[model samples]
Target chain A: MGMKCIGIDVGGTTVKVGLFETDGTLLDKWEVKSRKEEDGKYILPDVAASIREKLAGLGLDLKKDIVGAGLGVPGPVMPDGSVEVCVNLGWHHVNPQKELSGLLDGIPVKSGNDANVAALGEMWQGGGKGYSDIIMITLGTGVGGGVILDQKILSGRHGLGGEIGHIHVRDDEWEHCNCGGVGCLEQIASATGIAREARRKMAADSRDSMLRKFGDDVTAKDVLDAAKAGDELADEVFEVVARYLGLALGQAALIVDPEIFVIGGGVSRAGQFLVDRVFKYYDYFTPISKFKAKIGLATLGNDAGIYGAARLIL
Target chain B: MGMKCIGIDVGGTTVKVGLFETDGTLLDKWEVKSRKEEDGKYILPDVAASIREKLAGLGLDLKKDIVGAGLGVPGPVMPDGSVEVCVNLGWHHVNPQKELSGLLDGIPVKSGNDANVAALGEMWQGGGKGYSDIIMITLGTGVGGGVILDQKILSGRHGLGGEIGHIHVRDDEWEHCNCGGVGCLEQIASATGIAREARRKMAADSRDSMLRKFGDDVTAKDVLDAAKAGDELADEVFEVVARYLGLALGQAALIVDPEIFVIGGGVSRAGQFLVDRVFKYYDYFTPISKFKAKIGLATLGNDAGIYGAARLIL
Candidate 1:
């Protein structure tokens, strides 16, 4: 049999594991409950056990068949493979690469930030498949980003290389962002930010629209849905979202000059519609004749982390 | 003698040439008038002749003593060592790298944008001397920039990686920038921008200050000098420059996260005082706890381009 690799995406709630061929073909995928007990000391052992059980079931030998493993963790990862801190996993100064390698019987292991790996996965097989340089923006609970230069993740000096969510966009914002800054891109472009903006817009003036029907329980999805349904008020809200997103992206292009921008996350479910809106603003902000970064939606969905993790080992 | 390299900085009116040892010791430097006649066909030949004459005078052979050559042009350069266009030099689709190599008995040659090369030069032996990742901001006739990540110039997909001047910063700007963008960082943070803002501030109100003596003939230096001498109006003008420049640098940090930002060009002559002012706003915009990019002034001045170009060959 050809050599295989393991991909692990360690989230706050669960540990996603995937067995894949070196050619990126997934053979098996499963999830294990994350045990946060005792500073999450059992997490790597649990993952190792799960992989061993799966290999045994498939009659695979670790020494002969498995090549290595790669991991995607939810925190800043230093060049030395030690994580600075992960509030979700209760991890601090943990070297997952060394621990996982030791756990898997000295198999070679590598790791990167979850968002950065996901971007690598997308570049390897998703929206940024054909492009080498890319920036992936995830508008989930908070605005997250990953910068891929020359097909490698730019993890930066403090592992803050792709932290685009914190780019300040507004000057007059009164409220502070979760990062303690006011008017960050995350404060206006994230799913939470979109919902908050919807609520604020609704409160500012009584507009007759479908978003009003949701009352104070409006979500980003509802606002997107309402916009698609031709509601003027919700469309206005999305316009605001697109403006900040596009502006931030434009500014990012001035620095990295990626060939394409692949946008992912739950908010990307709006598809090409959101991509188009953001591109308009991106074009407006970057007036250089050579401004030619194409915007597209990510295709890997939830499995991007696993795919990216596997790519890391390869 | 040890192997030596040649660094060429091509400008509109003059071409600066430097001969250096592989270790970056500048042995000799000179300049030649740029001959724009005949579509700049004489530019390369003239540079090649100058280098040969200098080598002959030193009794050095091209094949035995010279390692390679590098060129820094005032335009975008593609990955294939070709320039898209240099309007200042009337160049279109020119491959200086290939042509120069042929001219120098087929020695290896490399080329990059002038601003990007300057950044590399600063990173190698100037203000960013000890840093591996840096962004060099040149606030001159225009706000030019070069991004150096991992000690190499990031000349982006279209060679616009460090084009920070075009980043849109204000939504209320009515005047169009040279690049056709409105409210670009260049329009607010550049030398011309500082002078323009100073004039506008002086005209907006009859405030008794040192700038009143210059009236309509005020220059960026006049404003900076007055500010340094405790002129409130001039100080206010510099505050605006600092605000825009700091905001742009903070946003740049979110993308590439360089270890240091080296401020260059004529305006940087204000030195540490200006650096301190810009840092204040850069700090306010980037509130991440791990945000730690230091700001400093470039030390090499004009020689940065030649040093950076030679480093390119090394």
Candidate 2:
């Protein structure tokens, strides 16, 4: 490879590592089991050591082979390269770039917020390939967004840019968001939001075809399956979710006006089921931005993080 | 001057023009009467001739002294510099930039949305000085916004970026907006919106001392004066307006997250009476962004458009 870099993705479950070329082509990929710790102070060193061992196993000398290392951790990374807070990982104000650089024997390291890294991944080699301005939204348990404006990841002054999940959609009715706001777009549109809404609608003595079959524990997937089978309640669930999401995206479109909105994560696996409904409601909400933009699904899957990280080296 | 440009502010009432140096220093300034017609084809040629005459009077050749001309029209400008649907100016699909350029003997002209240009003006020299990322809102009869991200003007794809006025504020129970949407930020928080709400409240029951004083005609300014005099109803109007405006700004902050929000236009002249009430309610709407950014009044007065247009030279 002309230029090589180490790409590391730290999640709550596992740590993914990849050896990638400057052009975002992955040479080899592997995952190491995360050493879960209640306290994050002890977790950073374990991650650093695991990456070093992986590089050694690949016969790649950290100091000679890699130009630098890029890490995407779950949470906000300060502009100065410190992980300010990771509620899930229980880390605060940890300088992962410095610690990782030291562990790798003075090799350079760069880090970003996880969603931002994912967006970069898409921009580099995934769904957002060849597009300079794109907005990536991951609809997992929570809705997270990453903004790439003019081909650069836009991290607001407080590292809070791309917080599309927190932007309000409803007026006075919505569940409290993880970020402590009510009526946030994420509260009614994410996977958790979709499941909660389905449960709420089903509990109101409302007659449903498929929901009545599945007793209490319902998931977003259940709604999708039922909708695919042409259940009224399941279709209604998707309509509600898409309506809120379309309104939020329309509002976001007024600000950034990205050429494309790439949807990712588990709920996005619903694919055209979710996208078609979103498009219908999108026209209803997107009066001003109708002629300006388009919406699409993210193409990259699990490896977007590594590809995006490697892209930073170029 | 290393680089100089002409800034022309075309409005329904008057035309303000200034020759500005690259450092945002005003070299010369003048104002001319405005002509509003159904199809005002003469406005551009007149403007261009006036500019040439003004430059000649100062012993400055238009071609040699000015690198380019920046025009700030009171509507959306096409990417090709043609204007579309200026409700205030009563023009539709007018190519003011091309017309002005033709009159200027083929000199290059750059144009932008009026609000966006106003923000560029502020960012270049006024209240938003030294800030690369800023959002400027003109709280006039309507609510208009200009967004600057990473030192470049964000006009979306079709020149509709800073349309902060059209974002949804309420789910229902507000006047319909011009965009055929219910509960737009403009429908509840603009001067026109405030006046309409005040009229409805006054019509409900005659308990307000301020309403009796104003009789049948109640404007946003009338409400402001009554609030200043401690009229309960007038104060209520201000409270409602401030509450909604703060909420809208907070929602906008979550998306753009600009370093500063500059408020201008006629209604914003209410000063602390407006800012204090807006800040009070802003916290309720924005929990995540409130800690990071601030909302302030626009420092540039009626000349904001001219200054904004002039700042393009800088």
Candidate 3:
């Protein structure tokens, strides 16, 4: 049998697992419910047991056929593979790499931040397929990002590399982000932020638009759908999002100067329409004629995390 | 004899050269006038002649005793060590690395941006000595920067990595930066920028300031000196500078998250006074309690470039 590696993406609700040929071809994939009780004590054990069962059913020897395992966690990870805290999974000081490796008959393991891993996945086989240096911006409920430099993750000294969402974008934001900072890019560019901006815009004016039909419960998807259908108010809200997102990406370009910026997550469902608008502002802010970083949409969808996780071990 | 390397810092007016041991000790240093009369055609050849003379004087063989040469140029250098344009030196499409290596009897040669090499020099033997990752901000005639990740220069795809000075920082500025961008950090934080801001502030109001004595001849040094002596107007000017500089550094921290930021150049002569003020704002912008990047002054002054250049070959 060909050498194999296991990719594990541990989220609050579920753990996505994938078995891949060492060369990155996905051979199988599955998921198991995450158990957060008793401080996530059962989560790792469950994942290990599931992997072992899968290996047995596939008639593969763990020590002989399996190369190693790669994990994606939802919090900052020290270079030593230990997590200080993962609030989503109620984990504290967990060494997933060591623990999972131990539970898997002494196989090796590597781990990284979830957002970072997703970016690696995209670079390996998605939007950033041909690029070695990229910044992946995930515009989900909260904005997340990852920086890949020369085909390696820029994990940073504090494990805070690619935390682009928290970069201050506006000085006028009155509210705080989940990270407790004011005027963060996440405040105006994430899915929640887009909906919030839409609500605020609708509340601030008597402008007639389709977003008004949803009132306070207006969703990001609804606003984006309306904007695509030529809703002026929705279009205006996206312009605001595009401005902040573009400005932040431009700033990132100045610092890291990645070859391309891969836009992923829920808001990215708007696709090239959103990308073009953001690129306009990114270009304006950067304006370096020969050094502009390309902007593109991520293509791996939910499976990017698994792909990136596997890439860590490979 | 021990293996040796030559470090050359090519500038607009002069070239600073240093002979170094392979382990980075500065054995001897000298300078040569840069001849820019012919598109800087003689600059590298002149530097090569000077190095060979020094090596002969010291009784060292060119190919047997000298390891290589490293060059720090005044413009963006491609990964291949070729420059598209270096206006200060009147150079275009100059491959300094190949040219210097050829002139120096085929010893290896590496080249990098001047600011980047200075940062590497600082990291090798200056303020960032112990840190493998750093962002060096040079606050001179123009704000300049270099990013070192894992002890190597992050020379971006477009050679724009660590070009933090051009990062957009403000929106209210009416004047365009030298780079043709509006509200760049260099507009408020460089030595020239500080003097300009002081002049604008003095003109805006009859503010009682020691800086008023300088009239139209006010300098960044005058402003900093006055601030050191408790001039309120000067203090306000620095507050603005600190705010923008800190904000830019914070933005950089979010992307590369280096272990420390090394502040260098003319304006950095204010020393820890300027560093403390900028750190205050950097901390405010990047309020991540556990992941703060330290700020410090660059210790190596003019010789940092040569030291870093030699480090390239080593």
Candidate with the greatest TM-score versus the true structure: 3
Most accurate candidate by DockQ: 1
Give TM-scores for every candidate, taking all chains together and pairing residue i with residue i: 0.97, 0.93, 0.98
Write the candidate numbers in order of decreasing TM-score.
3, 1, 2
Show where candidate 2 strays beyond 4 Å. A36-38, B1-3, B33-38, B78-99, B105-107
User: In candidate 3, which residue ranges exceed 4 Å CA deviation?
Assistant: none
Instruction: Compose the digit string of candidate 2's lDDT tens values, residues B166-211.
Output: 8766775655688877777787777888788788778886784766
Clashing pairs in 2: A121-A308, B121-B308
lDDT of 3: 0.92
Candidate number that wins on DockQ, 1 or 3: 1
lDDT of 3 by residue, A1-314 (tens): 68999899999999999999987789999999999999999999999999999999999999999889999999988789889999999999889999999999899999999999999999998999989999999999899999998888888888898999999989888998888789999989888999999999999989899999899999899888998999999999989999999999999998998899999998999999999999999999987545688999999999999999999998
At residue A142, give the lDDT of candidate 2: 90
Clashing pairs for model 3 are none
- Error at A166, model 2, angstroms: 1.0
Worst 10 residues of 1 chain A by lDDT: A283-292
- Backbone clash count for every predicted candidate, in the order shown: 0, 2, 0
